[model samples]
Target: MKTITKIFTMAAAVALFATTSLNAQTMMETDPNPAPKGMGFKVGVGINGGVFRDKSPMDYAYGADLKLQWDLTPYVAVTASGGYTKLIAKDNAVDADFIPAKGGVKVFPIKRMYLATEAGAGIAIQDGAKTNFIYSGGLGYEFGGFDAGVRYEGYVNDSASTTYFRKTGQYAVRLAYNFKL
Candidate 1:
């Protein structure tokens, strides 16, 4: 949809601007503690956009989420997030919209780089729509206070008969701003 495209474009611009501006500042100053103090909590808000897999009636997907993360160690963390997503339908098809709540783990193999996995339920928002099981995995990098990740997400429907597609997936990019809590 046009709205989704516009939002995605705007988010990309903002991210680029922030990254360029902050990179210069960070290079000029080195913090003694680049990582957070031991075992802390962080909160983040993000927006995502992606295209649906082939043969799907949906044209694109877009969403926003709020996440809470607890750092278990410098190399590990646990996260919980909830979000609203909309899969824009192709012509003559109905849209799919849901709210997803997920919990997962993040492992930092190297400084500021991480791998993540998550699974949860996606609750349908439309009347008579069925719930779905959702899962995702991704890799990302953190710089300054921004986290950018690319992920593949899938949705599975339990019932055989449904108004929406039974199995669908997308590849998405998420850009978030995080802060310690």
Candidate 2:
């Protein structure tokens, strides 16, 4: 699982650097209008489905997140998100649910394209409402009012339901609509 996390982290870093270099080259050749520095707000909701890395084949997971973004610069923003996740045990129909809240930075390496990473915490309602640390990283594109992306997320806990780092984490494809407010 650590190996998988390292691989994903490296991949994300490489993609970010490559995109940043390309954006720099493009900027040198073309003068694009600057994005407003004034504060801005955007709200979005997205859904994702994935498997727990440590869980057996029978465990299926899905979740939804609501996000609030504050654009501080053309290439930078701050984001806060919270959501609910459900893990279903296919064998016995047992279910575990969680609520996660996290905050992170969003960086746009190119127009309408972004890389974001965040960390915070989560609460598992089962097993006596245990709390765990949470984190995620993702890449996404925003076109007009629509956004789509993929992210890897994990909770750092070793519970009877989710055996801590054993499952590694989750990889999910996400889609959302961001409304500028």
Candidate 3:
């Protein structure tokens, strides 16, 4: 039964990955990147990364997410994002994979330039301590149905830290598809 389940899980993962890649390609091929609908809500997927310091060594982490956002003003927007992540080092001692309940505020005060901040709470993979207050901010450009973004995310343990170097922070460059609903 375990073997069957493992195979099933692997097959499912492959299927989903293929689908997303194909969808992205199709959109790129057919769409000339027109401006998305304005004054409405948008939702899409994104990827992220971060690193943490533990007793043993440092762990490098990567994550993927789906986000739903609402335009609160021409210069402000709010987003709900959740997704999977993994942290790796010598061995998988901590929960590298997690689906964090997170939110962000975005502002485009200047043309073609956006600034945003985000925070969240989540359960990590395995038995690692539950993470609290995931936060990030970045700059981005909105181009038609596609956006290019650069952001940084920080992961903090439930216990407070006295120094900045003790926290886990990941910097990322992301390209995302935008849609209206």
Question: Evaluated with lDDT, which candidate comes out highest?
Answer: 1
Q: Which is superior by lDDT, 2 or 3?
A: 2
Candidate 1 worst ten-residue window by lDDT? 23-32
Error of 1 at 1 (Å): 96
Q: Rank the candidates by TM-score, best first.
A: 1, 2, 3
lDDT agreement of model 3 with the native = 0.68
lDDT head-to-head 1 vs 3, winner: 1
lDDT of 2 by residue, 1-181 (tens): 9999999999999998888845334434542323345678899988878765545533667889999999997778999999998766555754667788899998988777889999997777765546678888989888877889888877666555442323346777788888788
Candidate 3 residue spans exceeding 4 A from truth: 1-38, 50-59, 90-95, 159-166
Candidate 1 stretches with Cα past 4 Å from truth are 1-34, 160-162
Q: 92 in model 2: Cα distance from truth in Å?
A: 4.5
lDDT of 2 at 175: 84
The stretch of ten residues in a row with the least summed lDDT in candidate 2 is: 27-36
Q: Give all TM-scores, in the order shown.
A: 0.78, 0.70, 0.65
Clashing pairs in 1: none
The sequence of per-residue lDDT tens digits that candidate 3 reaches over residues 1-181 is 9999999999999998888845334433532323233556888777766545455234666778788879776667788988876656545343345667888888877764688888887665545345556788889888766778887777676553211123566666666787878
RMSD of each: 21.6, 20.9, 23.5
Error of 2 at 147 (Å): 0.9
Who wins the TM-score comparison? 1
lDDT of 1 by residue, 1-181 (tens): 9999999999999998888855334446643334565698989999999998778767899999999999987778999999899988788687888999999999888778899999998989887888889999999998988999999999887664254675888899999999988
